[model samples]
Target: MLEQKHYDVVILGGGPAGTSAAITLARTGASVALCERSRYQENRVGEMLSPWIRPLLTQLGQWEQFRQAGHLSCPGMVCCWGNSQPYENEFIFNPYGSGWQIDRNSFDRSLALAATEAGANVFFHTLVVDVNYEERFWKILVRKDGELRSFKANFLINALGRSQFPHTKEKIYLDSLVGVAQFFQNVSDFAIDDRRTLIEATEVGWWYSAQLPRGKAIAVLMTDRDLLPVKPKDLEAYWKKSLLTTIYTIARVNFWHSANKLHIYDARTSYQDSFSGQQWLSVGDAAATYDPLSAQGIIKAISNGINAAHAIASSEFSHAVSFNDYNEALLSSFATYTTERHLYYDRERRWEHTSFWQRRQGNHKFLYA
Candidate 1:
């Protein structure tokens, strides 16, 4: 076993939020240790990067490099939401121009690399098994390839996406929404019209498909967990049946040569009762998760990470004022999100009779479970 190391801040998970927080703290001369469970080789699902990400990345000194990362530029979106007919929503007049369809493996690796360059110690393939607080510091136990190590920090940051600390407040899941998705290969030759993301609403749920970087594409069916098949083997059949129900998304799926097996992921809206504690705080999905329809997953994660880091840097780990302000901001933002989500779901009345749509039609707070 190696000697226990102490740092000013210890962060869990190396996704956008973790890396962003590490970069912010490291640049301020704070000792930061970031732990990630993956080696940046896995194919993570979140791909859409909104146009608003440019300002956030630029603020973190990573915009110029991200621009040269070879991600596909998404001009706009083609949505068949409230009505059956599809329409174009171009970004021609937007100040930030177009969004991006990124390869998560590469995009996430780049962010971790940036954090390393900023002087943070990044541990890949490391899992945090336990955490304890004593003597005004946090004690973390981590394991990698059967080897155990320990770390101590004055403050803690959880950016583990959907995963949360066992001791923190419980996550209030808004709905039982899940995405059954599949990836297709050899799609670089897809039509220019297919370059934009396609969103089609159906009676059962909604369909989202988009062209990905490196000659690949993705198609997903978002619906309630209870609405899916009971058996895992029957999910493909259900997914195919759902695909047939979409008009525009099915056409986009046809362009791909072949698809991999189906994978299910939680796509629900959730938030914790509190985002911060006495000496720790959560960011990204760990703080609050949004629906895919908002296309703000990455945007929100990075924004919260930067904001949280600034709050931490403004005062001591035990200071209540900055943490209080951070908590209040997160709650205010989540309240606004609930209102907007209800309005968007209410826009689709064609499926009002279905259980899936019925759950989303009323007040957003009522949907929480």
Candidate 2:
């Protein structure tokens, strides 16, 4: 039997949320352990960083390191939803600043490593198997190298991404099937003048394309559940077929090169059990997930982690208040996103001639707050 080690806080999942929380808690002189099932350098989407995250990164002393890693700066977004009149939204990140288009693999790893440097014990290749609360502490079971180990902590921060935890009946959110494609190639000729133009093609959910460093372009496609099958393996073929069915997507493909290599990412949104016990608090996508169309994934995750750390660092009563406040804020954010999504669909309904727009426009379930 392995001996159990104790810590003030134990964080599961080493993504942005978990790392951020670990770093924050460690900085406060709390004993912290962060466990990750996979290496942080895995390829994934949701790479577009909102300007809102810049302040937090700066506070954490990571902004300079991130910029030194050679990410592309993005000023704003240009949106086209199967319509002639496209919408443009510029972000004033600072009084006068811009956002970024990052390589997600490098970005995620760097954040996790930063937590380690901040004095948090980080374990990669460790899978959390069970979580139980006993007498005022969380007892976490983890499998590392096929060996079972246990750890005790005063509090547990669950930052496991979507669908990582066991599902329960009280969780009410439905799953959304989102398909994405990315590639890295020398496409300087096809580059748009505005780096922030994340194009969208309605009938499908949305598509964001941006230029990265080293003459590379990243294009992501998000499709509705009814239009695209769940978890299609051959994403290139599916993307080509989706483009053929929609005129808007066809124009988008025409704008880019046909020869570029394509990398695919499949994403989903499911309800999370936000709380397991008095000492366990779920953060980031572990607590709740949303559609990628909002472009709030990274920012939201970081914010939740920071909030969780603050709560855990305070007294017990303060922790409960913070968690309640976090939940209320998340609810408000979801409501706002749904309202905007519906409005976008309403605009698409006036312009697009397809069943995709019709179905989305009439989705009464989308208005749930």
Candidate 3:
């Protein structure tokens, strides 16, 4: 038999968004419960952090913890594009501070453990089955050990990444976004030569390669669903071969000889939902997701989580005002990133001698206002 429990807040999903929110609320003396369906050790990409996340982690006092975890330090980015003739540019983001490349599994679990240490009740391997909202509270149903258990909370946070709730459908559709990544070990030799990470633009989309703290390298390829015919089962093979054919990648083949050791990071789909609802709020990918070409996944996730926590703790609204504020912030961030991407893409497109480059350079669908 399962026991009944009550909390001031119940957060679904234990990724950066949920854990950070729980940690913040717990510090404010609120009773919080976090539910994560997957085990903490699950492997995933989105491990690269951006320059903007440093202050938030510092404020939360977790900067030292992240450093101790052996995250790769990245001072900036180097981007290359075009074929027969290519233009390469390096942007050192040192003014914004150096970012870290993490083992997401370890990083996420660390956040969850931090939440626990801060007094948030943390539950792993527990899946949220259904949510029933009432006039004063919410009834959350979960399946544990083949039995259904229910709990109540004064507030609920829908941090369920990529899982759309019933009310979220009309707001946004994520069926268009696509992402794929891989991890390779024994890459120390390449690390010494390629001091900074590289982002190469290709026909399908963009690709990123960076060295991890271990003697490993992480490479990711991202594009829209409309451009590629990738099913879940064959996504690995499709991404591997597709990446190898890119002109820039072929130029740097020597650095990728250990490609055979590649471990596929599952290709993922995502969408952005308008942040508006009562008694429930969505943060991180649950609210909005940018194309991975921006490499802002974890940074955006943690930043939004911190913002959501502040809004929830300080808000006086009974409805969705707080969530609306969060949405505005995210849109602003995305706007800046989209602008930079277009600039790089346009410059590369103009330099190419091939038909593919001409078409890509002409394609301006992602241009931002």
Candidate 4:
């Protein structure tokens, strides 16, 4: 006979959103299972976290723990957008003070740890092989270490960032934006002082670079997929050539240090047709994804997780439970995000005639992929 376990809630993808929901539900005396695909040893992206994240951590009761994690403090950001002149968006003026530049792997593990401490079953290196809904319960099959485990839950939360299951709705992509990134580790004793993130806009696209903890750093180039001048085989060469076009971003990199190979990932703005259904709902990047320029992906994920947990808890013992408010809030936020994104992109008129800018300026219709 196969091993089978049941829980009040089963969350897929132990990212910020999943762990947030798990921590919340577990604290409320609800049995929760949080499954993560990665083993937590690999490096993940999305390094910068704004100061606004403090409240969310505090709400989850992990603020002090996060403070002691030793992540680098980000005082502000430096941008060269709209024109050649660089400007500072300092955070010292804000009441929350400095944000953080973290090792994403460690950050995520911390959240999962919090969930476990809150009485949730946290599973790593677990892959969801199948999902089915029947008889008012979610039947999920997961594979871990050559063994298959079955789980049944009264409610399911989809926090699977960027990767959706077969039951989820299709994602409507607003654009084909992608990011080519490279990570580096300082092999020698090279002292550097500037900690603010750098964003330099060029005719082709934009560049983002930041200093991470432990003498590590990352630099990424954002551009439309179709706008890439070279094919996949020549992407590394193209990445280097594009770096030469930047004014300030180039100064932030140390070519002499050992760097990882170029990594390409989707950085587009997209949303699902629906966010919630009967006994199931999506959260974080699974429901909607924002452009990295907003720098609110993780924040949005944590917020969604917390909200979803409440919705589930409220409906657990009642048949009249409704997720309409949750859906409406997500839609409203997306609408506002779209408008703000348009205005931000419009600010860069130097590359108006370029295909990359033209698509973002509403000259091109949204394409389905």
Candidate-wise lDDT, in order: 0.88, 0.72, 0.69, 0.88
Model 1: per-residue Cα lDDT at residue 77: 89
Per-residue CA lDDT of model 1 for 1-369, tens digit only, reads 568899999999999999999999999999999999999986789757778888999999999899899898888888999998888888888899798989888888999999999999999999999999888788999997778999999999989889868768778888899999898887766353557888899988999888888888899999999999899999999999989888878777777777788889999899987898868889999999999998888888898999988988888555343488898888888888888888989999997999999999965563332
Task: Tell me the tens digit of each residue's lDDT in model 4 across 48-99.
Answer: 8999999999999999998999788999999998999999999998788898
Tell me each candidate's RMSD, in Å, in order: 1.8, 3.5, 4.0, 2.2
Instruction: At residue 88, give the lDDT of candidate 4.
Output: 96
Worst 10 residues of 1 by lDDT: 360-369
Q: Which stretches of candidate 2 lie over 4 Å from their true place?
A: 92-96, 167-171, 186-193, 229-235, 244-276, 316-322, 350-355, 362-369
Model 4 lowest lDDT segment of ten: 360-369
Q: List model 2 lDDT by residue over 1-369, tens digit each.
A: 779999989998988889999888989999999999988555566566777777889867798898799888888877776465667788764663787887777788898899999999999889988888777777899998788989998888888876455423355555555665766466664545667756666455666677666666666667655566566566667776655655433554455563555554445554444444466677778876766766778887888898888877885423243366666666666667666766765766543556555555655444443
- Model 3: lDDT equals 0.69
Task: Mark the regions of model 4 whose C-alpha exceeds 4 Å error after superposition.
Answer: 187-191, 317-320, 362-369
lDDT of 3 by residue, 109-175 (tens): 9899999999999888888888888767877988765678778887788788767765577434323
- Which of the two candidates, 3 or 4, achieves a greater TM-score against the reference? 4
In order, how many clashes per candidate? 0, 0, 1, 0
TM-score of each candidate structure, all chains considered together:
0.96, 0.85, 0.82, 0.95
Report lDDT (Cα) of residue 350, candidate 1: 92
Model 1 deviation from native, Cα RMSD in Å: 1.8
